[model samples]
Target: MAVDSYDFWLFDLDGTLVDAEWSYTRDVFDRVGDRLGRPFSDREAEVLWHGLGGARDDQLREWNIPPTEFWPVFHAEEDPQLRAEATYLHDDAAELIRSLHARDRPVGLVTHCQAFLTGPVLEHLDIRDWFDTVVCCTEELGWKPDPAPVRHAIRELGVEGEGTGVLAGDGANDVGAAWNAGLDSIHVERHDPAFRGQCVLGDYRITTFRDLGQ
Candidate 1:
């Protein structure tokens, strides 16, 4: 596949570009758990972290805690750490972005994460300039697996022609969004078989951005 042929490339933020090593939910969960006298175990934290799935509010609900009560404490202590840790981007992410830019291919970012979370990572990496557009979860635009956000991004970037755009992401929702929008999709996975039964759905499945060339 010649990446240069694509007029626009859309990317997913969490797990695709940045590894979620220092998740805010994990920090808040642990802190809140300790404070509430219900500390989470390593196993429990792992499950809760994955279940959070980029939505902070969902995690709070799972714990049966009110955001008004919990978030202030979390904001004071854990939010800063989350911001600091998000500073690290994936090893190949910057290189991939640079390569696409060098090819004169316009890059856009589509993330389920809110602007508050996405903004700092883009700023910290100093690669915000590389993206031509960023479509995040706002009041008007809903989450991924819903084609509306993806379509909005494609329309916003003004990319036309069949297969002229690609949506690159790591989850099933990402694949579904691309297919729904009538665009080619490249699935970037950390390990194989996470979407094994559904492998036939994606146009391409790769472990790294480097594989896009092949």
Candidate 2:
């Protein structure tokens, strides 16, 4: 089905709708590396930054890095303002979200990006009001692929049992969350699936919103 076929819509933020500049991503990783006493190669930075390799913890473990040790430093090194300044919204994402909001459709955001960072990016992009509800995944609420956060956003949108809903994102975990929550999904591939080492399946898959046949 087309994007317009969904009664309600959910979105992922970083890499899906908005993304930070490469320089910003590089800087964050550089600082994280310094703190950990180990430097990350450009490829490692890219993979971790975009979650291109799938489960972040699993990826870290493969690199012999302890996730428990890596995450805190990683998050600590991110400067919200600088990251926001470096962030840009995808043009097709802009078109789709604005169109949905303009139509008063129930649109929500369910992202792994924490509240501190998510707030600044949305504000910087001036698109905060577009979503009827925004759900930032937390340790307590659980992360994507678990269905808790997606279900939380669905509850907040008050669209439960109203009609069909769908979540669109750029990661496998996003698709997993959608299916786990009993919602349709769209995988917007922002990078080469080869880089991720697997093709992320969804109810629909496209590289851009235009490909959704909206």
Candidate 3:
């Protein structure tokens, strides 16, 4: 199917459309490590920040860090305003989103980013209105790859399940969630497959939104 053929669209925020500066990412990890009394090398920080190694909990386990102990400190160390200032949108993503918004298409955001940070980033970027619905993954709604959050966004958009819908993201979890919800998936490969240690298959794979002829 063509990109414009979808009845509605859903996207992942952090890596797919926008990303934080490396300095900010590094600082966050530094603080996390300080709090945990465990120092993370630059490579380890990069992998965890971009989820390059796949599931974060699994990576944490491999590093011998208790996920239960790591997450709270990680979230606590992330300052919303600082993060928002450091975030930037991909040009291709911006063009595609603006085009979709101009056409009055239904677009939603489903992200692992918490509500507090998501709000600030959207506001700072002045693109909050681009999305008709924003679904921040939570314990209650469930995370991506589980389909609950994507389904929740679909419900919020008031779109029918039978209509062709597509979800795009830069992670395996996004593709999994789309497939689980019976939607086509777009894998936006923001990082090299070799660096990720695996290729995330999707209905469509591209390096950028331009590959879809946005």
Colliding pairs, model 2? none
For candidate 3, the lDDT comes to 0.91
Each candidate's number of clashing pairs is 0, 0, 0
Estimate, for each residue in 4-109, the C-alpha lDDT of model 3 and write its tens digit: 7887899999999999999999999998999999999998998888777777889999999999999999999999999999999999999888888777779999
- Ten residues in sequence with the least summed lDDT for candidate 2: 96-105
**Model 2, residue 86: displacement in angstroms?**
0.4
Q: Please state every model's RMSD to the true fold in angstroms.
A: 4.4, 0.9, 1.1
TM-score of each: 0.75, 0.97, 0.96
lDDT of each prediction vs. the true structure?
0.70, 0.91, 0.91
After superposition, candidate 1 runs with Cα above 4 Å error: 22-25, 32-81, 160-163, 191-201
After aligning candidate 2 to the native by TM-score, how far in Å is the CA of 73 from where it should be?
A: 0.6
Tell me how far the alpha carbon of residue 171 in candidate 2 is from the true structure, in angstroms, after superposition: 0.3
For candidate 1, write residues 1-214 as lDDT tens digits: 7677577799887778875664655776678677766776664565443322324456667767675766555445455436646556777777788888787787888887667667777777777887888999555887666788888887777775535788988776787788887878988876445423234257888888888772
